[model samples]
Target: MSRKIKVLQLQNRYNVNASDLAEQVIQGLPAERFEVTTAFLRGRPGPGEPESRAARSIYFGFSQSDLKGLRLRALWRLYRLWREQRYDVVIAHRFKPMNMLMLLNRCLRIPACIGVQHGIGDFDRAYRRWEARRLLTANWRIVGVSRAVRDYLVGCGAGFDAGNTVQINNAIDIDRAERLQHPREQARSLLGLAREPFIFGAIGRLVPVKGHIHLIEAFAQVQSVYPQAQLAIIGEGRMRAELEAAIARFGLGGKVQLLGAREDALQYVRAFDAFVMPSLSEGLPLALLEGMSGHLPVIGSDIPSLRPILEDCGGRIFPVGDVATLAKQLGAVLNLDAEQRRAEGERAYSYLRGAHAIEDFRLQYLQLIEQSLAAERAAL
Candidate 1:
């Protein structure tokens, strides 16, 4: 390669999760090996901002409207941007950029165009079909955060080269998260959470697919068994009103609090006795990993993506959308003796550091880029 691998990261403003992970990866990479620049479909202030500084150029556009209109404007702006700018590689997050990326890469001939799947959640049929077409392109790499996603694409009968897909699980710096364990009492004191409450927390957008509602239902079941419990959900989304209503309907207003996007969430991760993700669909969620890294016992929905991460890590896995099953599992896990839960947490940490190590994952990504770029140069 003649120059540093200049990767142009394309993202939507609403893609808070993907952007956060991308930025962290960029910052975490060896500086001499890469140059990461970003272009946001609609940029706003949120958790993904600070670490995105590695990007030599940052392009911000796109405004949040309903999903459909946002898609339209994103397509137009992206094509224009591709025509105007130059990049060695383009890494896009979300469906919009992926849809037009083929044409843009064809026009620009960027050696690498990688797509990062941030989550396993999806919308209606039209959206799924649209996603398939958006991701179809030659010499493109699709990094599915979970094996389920990689398999989904293959099963859907998309006409792309089968080998083009890669399963790159989302990873985090667990060392930092381990340090977040400053003393459970101290973390609780900082968050003003009850030092004695058996606090359970979920961090992510409170959308339907996130299955926050399901978690709430499970918590309701849990409350019947353990009275000294409270649920703290971190992050905001469209389902705020609905979720708030659910909390009240269950008469859990006092027991449940929707804390929107905490700045010191990792630090506060220590306060929670358990980290719950009742998501219906996911692509190896980062929150689950963070939860495990913080040594919080994980209780995840039993799904392909989730099972691969949580099943054997002393993390309890339950069936997706089966409220009764999730509730049963939740009650059982939450009721474990303190020592048993702590031992489970230790197991989770060891598994996370081994399978989802940041250094290994990052190196894999870098290797992909290097090999791809090398092949391109050889062809040239």
Candidate 2:
């Protein structure tokens, strides 16, 4: 009998939604043909936090300082682990873990090394691009979590051309997401929201990149026309003070609420009458996908990563960071009657089912891994 291929899935940290794609890699690969081990370079899962589902899991527990600068100690430790395990394939997520593996694999010669880029501008630095160009080999493959990310990598002059790069849209477990969601009434109650107001919802870090300020500006305009309209945002970040200031500036103190970071935020998605994502940039946001899974009419900025998804799903899209356009889109959704809004939401869910289904996501990853292994065997 052929020996099972051993694989390592490396990530920088364990975050709730951010880590789900790596976990999907673990769950996607068939057990009979492969054995997968997951490693976190910095932190371990906290209580009630989801852990890796790989056959085996390791937590490096390195501090932030350890991974900065030359990352000598981290590199040495990872090198020791790689030598001991002699993994047939290594899949590294994001930049740090991917860079470390690229450096070490140059010597260890891991048969197949896959680096997954979750966002754009990762290779903006000259040194990082030089390192990638120098260290990457025939067995190395780069995967972008979205088509925009793939294009960014290919155009970045970092040795990631069309030949070595592939696009794999991020996905979520639709069944699990739908099952975990609270019913609309229960979700609203949990969020301290009154059912009378039409709530426009968003879930993301309150950062400049997320464009929460712009979302607030747009909602301020919408609320003036429709006093019944309210806005609620989930998640916390350094920009909390700034976002609060914006709310105060608009005199939306009671009408708009920053719910702050809630664990399992997807559960409360049903509380929203309509979902909005006004991100300035993204590499295929899973929150927007989760919102669609909730069967809610959606609105988003027309950035490259979000445009196709929203357009295809029949969701409203405004130009990125354009508050007037965003407000216009929000008002358009507000204008829809209950049945019309439901139909629009159903269109989104149908598109999600056909395009971003977890089954298709898993099959694509499995095929990529198998093809990488097959290429290695052919070369040998």
Candidate 3:
């Protein structure tokens, strides 16, 4: 019998979507032909660190200085780990891990390297862009979470080999999402939400990119049309104080609530009458997918990353960062009858079932891994 191919998955942090994707990929691989381990490259666990499920897990415990500066020490530690493991293939999530893996791969001729880009418009630095082009060579592949991201990288002169670069949308565990979800009224009761209010909900970090302030502005306009409307943004970030001030400034203190981070936040999505994400940027946002998995009518920024999903799934879209347009969309959605809303939600769920099933995502990655290894052997 052929020996199993040993693999390693690396990410800079543990709680985010990248980690989640890595975990899913690890779990989904064929057990007989693949053996997988996982690692994190940075500081200690945060409040949101996911439960580890890899066959083995490692942490570099990088300090603040290591993360802020050139990260030379971290690189050294990674090099040692790579040397020790001698993995047949290394899969990296996000830029930091990808860049570091490239450096190591170039120096030591790592057998195979795969990088997954999880966000759109994330490369803003000239050096970072240059690095991407420089690092993509033989035995290396970059996977984009959306077609838009792959196109952007290729167009921007990232040296991704045309055959090697690919687009794979993020997938949610549909069964798990369904199991976790509560009925609308029960979910609302869990959150102490009144049954009378029309709740429009969003879940994500409270960062500038999420465009929560704009969502607030739009919700304010929504209130003018439907006084009983309430907006609840779940998740927390650096922008909390700023968003709070804006909510007060707009006199929406009574209608808008920032619920901060909750471990079970996705389960409560059922409480929303409709879901919204006003992100300025994204790469197939998992939050949006989770919302859709709950069969909620979604409203999202009409950027390239989200437009296709919204278009395919029967959801509403507004121009990015446009508060007025978002408000208009929200008002129009509110005008829909109960049957229309249910139809919209059903459409989203149906689209997800066909287009972004977890099994398809896993199969694609497995094929990529096998093909990459085959190419490496052919080159030899």
Candidate 4:
């Protein structure tokens, strides 16, 4: 019988989306052929510890605030663990964890490393671009969560081997998403929202990159024509003060509300007349998927990261960061009759189910691992 391949999944922190993807990957792998463990490169576990669903989990203590100090501490600690376990593969998600694994591979000559690029914006920094070109050297493969990210990495001269760089989009749980959604009336009641107002909802971090300011601006414009319209933004971030000021500046105090972060946020998706994501950048956002899964017609920025999904799922798109265009799109959707809006949403859900199945995502990762392992053996 063939020995089971032991794999380690690493991430900088256990944020919701990253953790979810890691858990799905671990859960989906064939038990007889693979064993998986997960580790976080920074931060201590909160309330319920070891959030990832792996056979085993570990935490490597290193402060994110101190880059030089982190390198010394993480490198020493990871080396000790790598020598002891001798894992067959180490799949690192996001930039910091990937960079750490690449450095470790260079020094200790340990396991085969896989770097997963969950997004694309990080390379904007000179230091990150330099590190990308200099550090990644080993038996390694890099997976981008979207085609745009893969193209961006190669365009930046990151020196990733042409043959090994690839794209595997983040997958969604269509069944779970559909089950989580409540009926429109019940969902509104659950959130203490009134049904009379035409709700335009958005869920994302309130950071500048999310373009909440622009969304708020666009919604204010939509209010000029559709006075009954209200905007509800879920999630919290450092930009609250600025966003609040924008609301006041536009005199949308009563019309717009920052709902903040809610654990049950996705359940309330159906409460909205339509869902929108005004992100300036993204790599297959999970919120968009959940919105579609709830059968809400979507409106999003026409950035490369979102085009593939919007084009397939049949949503309205506006130019990135253009408030007037977004307002125009919002007005167009709001003008649709209930039946017309429902039909658009149904089309989106059908496309989402057909294209982004969680099982297919799992199978692709498994195949990648198997091929990587086989290539390694053949080389020897």
Number of the top-ranking candidate, with lDDT as the measure: 2
Give residue 124's error in model 4 in angstroms: 4.6
Among all windows of 10 consecutive residues in model 1, the one with the lowest summed lDDT is: 61-70
The superposed Cα distance between candidate 1 and the true structure at residue 182, in angstroms, equals 3.5
Compared with the true structure, the alpha-carbon lDDT of candidate 3 equals 0.85
Model 4 segments more than 4 A misplaced: 16-19, 124-138
List model 1 lDDT by residue over 168-228, tens digit each.
7667777766765568889778766778888888988878889999889888888877888
Error of 1 at 187 (Å): 1.4
Enumerate residue pairs that collide in model 2.
none
Count of steric clashes across candidates, in order: 6, 0, 0, 1
Against the hidden reference, what TM-scores do the models get?
A: 0.82, 0.93, 0.91, 0.91
Q: Which stretches in model 1 have alpha-carbon errors above 4 Å?
A: 14-19, 44-51, 63-85, 121-138, 160-162, 236-254, 257-261
Scored by TM-score, the top model is: 2
Candidate 1 Cα lDDT to native: 0.74
Better of 2 and 3 by lDDT: 2
After TM-score superposition, the amount by which residue 85's alpha carbon in candidate 4 deviates from its true location, in angstroms, is 0.3
lDDT per residue, candidate 4, 191-223, as tens digits? 777878999999998999899999999998989
lDDT of each: 0.74, 0.89, 0.85, 0.83
**Prediction 1 TM-score vs. true:** 0.82
Q: Against the correct fold, how does model 2 do in TM-score?
A: 0.93
Residue 369, candidate 4: C-alpha displacement in angstroms: 0.5
